[model samples]
Target: MNRKEFLAKLGMGAAFALTATCLGSCSSDNAGETGDVDFTLDLDAAANAELLQEGGFVISNKVVVAKNSDGEFVAATVVCSHEDLEQIVFQNNIWRCTAHLAEFNQQGEGLNANGSNGLAIYQTELSGNMLRVFS
Candidate 1:
């Protein structure tokens, strides 16, 4: 190839490489979690103590933390399966995704109006002042 054509091709290739690298790093890691969702939060403080109440929920970092009727903690992704919207809230012990009226149980087994897959649930361990949530 001519020198000018070779240089142009090289520049295009470099641009493509840079774009690929940026896109690769842009993929959502979602709250600094690895492939596994092992994360911990200190919920024993007065500010966070609201999570212990029945039907209470705290949403942060793409995850929803809620307490069931039995005062047990449950964790799940806040994204609604119906439209992938992050409008999840807890009310009356049920997780309702306000984006499209999708609802899930304490075990995250409920479904959206379209009958698609339910919310993704994470296992929670509440001990002392630490709450560890994982899947």
Candidate 2:
């Protein structure tokens, strides 16, 4: 190839390489988490609202729904990773384990640094005021 044509191709190749490297690094930072887990609860037709308001309405052997600070609802697993005790308590927009006092935010993010992990969160959907959490 001519000298000018060779230089043009080299410059184009370098630009493409730089673009690929930037995109590669940016995507790698977000690779850890796939997505949030989901769990769904089917409340019985005669389910008592008062019981739900009191919290600790067990959806199954693995899940529970509780009201957050806004009175909106959220769900998480009742199983505590620390001691496998079902001690999840809802108060002030957070879920706390009464057994060991491990705290987690509404989105299931660990709020403490005491080696206590966050509760597992389930994605919620509302259908006519009925909240559905998928597992």
Candidate 3:
């Protein structure tokens, strides 16, 4: 699909369309130093309950780990495409940047309004009681 159509399908309005120049810098060259995920989260850890609870999330190591409204686990790089801030907040199944109000859905689709870019979503896997997030 064309860029415009792809953006539209993600709920990104015309204003948020990504130009060729901007698209080139949307994400980092390296998502992980190694092929493996950096950490293994304990699902039973009390400290992680809030993040694992529905509609809750936590930002650390430039990544956001959240439990969306559906109680499904989701993860994404927290760096804002607009200003490269790690200040991302998750609410109502959407991730928003505090610096520029850039918004993206759980599936990592950038929304309209601030002309910001989408975040890099990661794969979340549940293995026994541990949750692993990877690029």
> Over the stretch 17-99, how does candidate 1's per-residue lDDT look in tens digits?
75665454333313222236777778876756778688777875678888888888888887765546678788788878664
Which candidate order results from sorting by TM-score in descending order?
Answer: 3, 1, 2
Question: What tens digits encode model 2's per-residue C-alpha lDDT throughout 30-120?
Answer: 1112244454444444552532554434444456677654656677776654445677666566777665456777777767632145567
* Estimated TM-score for each candidate: 0.67, 0.55, 0.68
Q: What's the residue-level lDDT of 133 in candidate 1?
A: 83
Count of residue pairs whose backbone atoms collide, per candidate: 0, 7, 0
Position 69, candidate 2: lDDT: 49
How displaced is residue 107 in candidate 2, in Å? 1.2
lDDT of each: 0.69, 0.58, 0.69
Task: Give the best candidate by TM-score.
Answer: 3
Query: Taking the tens digit of each residue's C-alpha lDDT, what string does model 3 give over 46-71?
Result: 87777656988866556788888887
Count residue pairs with overlapping backbones in model 1.
Answer: 0
- Misplaced by over 4 Å in model 2 are 1-61
Q: Model 2: what TM-score?
A: 0.55
Output the better candidate (2/3) by TM-score: 3
Rank by lDDT, descending?
1, 3, 2
